[model samples]
Target: MQVFGIAEPGAPAEEIEIATPELTGASVLVKITHSGICHSDVHCAEGYFDLGDAGQMPVTDAGAEYPFVLGHEIVGEVVAAGPEAGVEPGDTKYIVYPWIGCGECQPCRDDNENYCIGAKRNLSIALKGGFAREVWVPDSRYLIPVGDLDPAWAATLACSGVTGYAAVSKVLTEEVDRPIAVVGTGGVGLSAVALLAARGHKNIVAADVNEASLENARKAGATATVLTTGADPVTDLVTAGGGKLAGAIDFVNNGATSGLALGAMGIGGKLVSVGLFGGQLAFPTTVMALNQLKIEGNFVGSLPQLRALVDLANSTELPKLPITEAPLEAQTVNDTLQGLAERTVVGRFVMVS
Candidate 1:
């Protein structure tokens, strides 16, 4: 297999030859079809996360080593499954859920592998990412079948979908009937809108400073769009988000976005920060205590939550999220990761194998 990876933070990614193991090993062999470029990948490459905390991370899992292939949003076909694999040959394609978990951890035992805290935890961090001609997933648990859907689009769903779904569902409560506002109109935000619409939630609100992104949000089932440029952007988002907002989701994960989401939330409402964007918010502790407002941090969901999202994808006839693709080798880093950081990419970018 051929792969592109970085040996160190901020290092130039290079094309390298990777050897594929047997069809039946500790991992499953997937014929790579598509992978998405994400801002998280750039962060990892730039060492925003301490590899020292590499404890229980997929990148530092026991069986794999770096130079890490950064992509985690993956969709591909099963060429061969491991010894205890669930599917047989010729089955429909699926996604690599990305978080390779050690099934024995307390979190894993509870099916909360995304929060695994065990020592020497299982991971794909150092493992080869999906930016390759072929890749191997440490376990079949990571694979979710996506038959016939566009691999590129499905790839976006793997990360962005999981992130959005997890964030919204985490803070949402039955107490509020008002609309849910999703800030940032990128892939993750769009997926959040699509998932909410699929769940029959009308009055889904989308906010972005970009016209193109705002237009894209409309296509993703947003009932209203707010361009966040004027003074008092919160007023616009508050109006777009229902009068008494149930929750505000910030997928941009920056301090500015976090603040906006916080400000936009109505009393007793919740603000969930899901993106890795560099931002912080000074909480309204007084209002939070009095109004019962909430601030929650949501990572990707539990496997079952992800499975449910995939199951919904299997049956839903929702409008396809717009996407652009480039061959893995043909891509330049500036266009994908940097584009994400710059908020220049309208939708997801798929690197086809």
Candidate 2:
């Protein structure tokens, strides 16, 4: 099988050939057909995350070798399977759950491998990822059938789609019409907005530094959009939130957006931080105590959440965020990573095999 990956930190992805591993136990091999290029992939290629004040946090393991294959949002057809693997080798495609973990861990036992405490088995991180012609999955259980969903869009459900779904689910309240802010209108942010609208939420405020992104947020069902480029961005958000935000999800959980989300919250508001943009957040303890505000961080999502999101996509007409396709090649992968790093990608970029 051939793969494209970062040969060195801060270098463009390059092509490499490797021998196909033999399947065992419940293991299954998938022939890659569609994979989404995410912003996290850019961080993977760069080898470190920017930690605003403290320093850079390296993602590279000292013991791990270079040319790390970076792609997690994956979907493909089953090509080969172990004797116990349930799926058959055919044209049917399934979205692979890339957040693998030690099945013995408590979180994994609870079917929430995204929160696994044991040895990390996450694809694109601890293992070779899906930016290749094929990926070896440990078990067929992680393969969620795509059904009639668009393959390119379905690829995102493994990560961005489910991440958005889980984050939006965290902020749900009985007061469905209350103002809720979605900070950052990137691919995941837009997904959150659409999910909120689909679930009958009446007031959704989308905030972003880019006007173009804000426009796309409106199309995704945001009742109001705030451009966080003015003198008082928090005030802008609060106004867009219909006086005070009932809840907020910071998709770009950087210093500025985090502050904006926290500052605009009303009493009893909740803030769910769901981005790896990287930064330290300092909020007044007194205000948090007085307002009874709750703050938490969210990883991608649980296995069940991914399955639920796929079901929702199949049942509802979720707004299709612009999906641009590029050939799954070394140069194209590098270009997509560069586009993500520069914040130029409007929606999602899917690589086709």
lDDT of each: 0.72, 0.88
Q: Flag clash pairs in model 1.
A: 58-123, 58-124, 58-125, 59-125, 59-126, 253-277, 254-279, 255-279, 255-280
lDDT of candidate 1 over 109-185, digit per residue (tens): 88887786754232236457776666777777778877766778787777778787787687556553477888887
- Write the residue-wise lDDT of candidate 2 on 218-283 in tens digits: 988999999999999988888887889899999989887898899999999999999998888888
lDDT winner: 2
Q: lDDT of candidate 2 vs native?
A: 0.88
Q: On a 0 to 100 scale, what is the lDDT of residue 61 in model 2? A: 52
What is candidate 1's local distance difference test score? 0.72
Question: Residue 8's C-alpha lDDT in candidate 2?
Answer: 83
Which numbered prediction scores highest in TM-score against the true structure? 2
